[model samples]
Target: MPSFLRWIACRAMLAACLAGIAASARAGCEPLTEDGHDYVACRFDPRSDALSLYWRGADGMPLATTERLADAVAATGRKLVFAMNAGMYDTALAPIGLYVENGRMLHRANLRNGAGNFHLKPNGVFYFGDGKAGVMETGRFLKARLNPAFATQSGPMLVIDGQIHPKLQPDGASEKVRNGVGVRDDGTVVFAISTEPVSFYAFARLFRDRLGTQNALFLDGSISTLYAPPLPPVGGWRSLGPMLGVTAGP
Candidate 1:
């Protein structure tokens, strides 16, 4: 075989190996700082793990904690490997917008013109089904009619089509511990939470520039929470609204 041909084959093999690693990336959450702000991020491939959304459990009450969610998952012969507050909620712990779990649309998409980050124009949804997942602007999602098995709606998209949300200012004053989710070009889902108060601009940049996601949505702020065993726990409120998580076989 020609030397050039052998080199091409080696490069292809290396690409394949890298893809496999990304496809099964559940090693742990990573902590890092970008532009003077600190954050912890985790990546997972929906195609490889059974990613689902949860609200009320078998007892007809919300599973309000990681331990409870874990128990619920264990009941089905699975282990809760990852969990995160998926969206903003009202006073009664109800999703402010669309919330679909296990193919049931509990809360239809809230299209009313209102206030808060959730009502911010261009809010988006994070949804997945079968072997694929995506983050898309709510309008686009509604038009697409993807009908994902599990979906959660949140506001003020961080990044769209590789560009940061137009309204987020680079030096915006408001800042708080925040978390959001994004979908990579390869269909990998990335979740990130700022370790400290960070402006919406920086957070959006974290997803667009650092994470390389074409579309990303801001899940929540201040009450942003995550529960990946590999990393430390984070929950601003006693209980969260819609929860998104991954499960591993028991």
Candidate 2:
């Protein structure tokens, strides 16, 4: 065989071996802290339906709200945790959780434009704001713009993150209930089709299946924000409304 070809093969083999070792090391330990409040924290159990809900804390730690939570699982060492900003009472109410202001809930659409929208849709991320809503074709349209390694053209079926979910489609227009994800009666995660100007609950759900969630409830929606390292993996986090949190090194 040609020397160049042999050398190329050797490099490929070495890369594969390193990846295997890394995967094994990552799998070594998956710890979910118990007791004490975590600035960044999340929970999942073998018995449960691959559930995941993560958030940052006001104590100045990582939080998870608007961003997709599954990516955190693939990240090594970092953990996804959840918290509620009871301080922000009522800001706005989406199809899911209540929006809050200054730790108090408030629901005034005119307050902010991009306040309640998720950019990515199953097809692609659409534009939503300025008394206008954005639209995209589908995954095919978004594939080019999204990170190949992290983003998928199509969303997961069955269960989104371990909870039973329903197949959702976008309801674009003033009926901007465009982004939608579902949960099962037994508590499974179902994702909504991606849409431009994403909606809250676009990739979120809560199920009653897990013992921990007897009466599963949805946390935050578009106002939700997640803070983990290597920013801009899937979506970016903005300082919107109140953020429920659990963090690290706090």
Candidate 3:
């Protein structure tokens, strides 16, 4: 099919998936397309879905892989239905920026200027608590002075206040499998991963345009991975830093 045709078809699919979706949403993924790029979006609500973040296991080591996380949660009589790499990490697999899990601040916000995607100015944080979620630029988030139950800091925000990152090119040459998160106006959290390699601008637009999120944060590239099965590999992921997922009790 022509690229435009495919894009149209995928938009229709996304609309159908979102129709009637609310706090009742389950951990299910749907195919989406934006400006000819293919993506898979999985949505859930912390109000009803067991949306949460994970880092260490019972043994106090990073749970690194989705497969391993699934095993660990299962042992606790829970079902892990959704997961994705949460943010960039160091060689030791520690989140490079602020990381809060279960209302506990495990790491502090990173404000030092440095190289790489994480240092992209206006990097933001995705946070949730009390059944509410939001995406905010790291600076603004700090000024807000609100503490959330769970939050992860990631770089080069895809969208801010409804605008794409000022630095990304609409048709940039760089392309790779990418994933990110956004919060819809209704406080519903959406996680997405590009099915095919895509540019940063394209991926960012997927959240703002098609997904209707006011703000979005780029989680990672190439290493981006979504744990929605039956979907494609998404990308290679292991030794990942903080991770987010949805679970259900047995």
Q: Encode model 1's per-residue lDDT on 91-209: one tens digit a residue.
A: 77789888888889999998888878998889999999898999989989999978888889999999999999999998899999999999999998999999899999999999989
**Candidate 1 ranges beyond 4 A from true positions:** 1-27
TM-score of each: 0.88, 0.26, 0.88
Ranking by TM-score: 1, 3, 2
Candidate 3 or 2, higher lDDT:
3
lDDT of 2 by residue, 180-244 (tens): 22323333322222212332223232122322322122222333333323321212334333332
Q: What is the Å distance of residue 169 in model 3 from its true position?
A: 1.9
lDDT of 2: 0.29
Error of 2 at 170 (Å): 11
Indicate whether candidate 1 or candidate 2 has the larger TM-score. Answer: 1
Report the Cα lDDT for candidate 1. Answer: 0.87
Provide the overall lDDT of each model, using Cα atoms, as 2-decimal numbers: 0.87, 0.29, 0.86
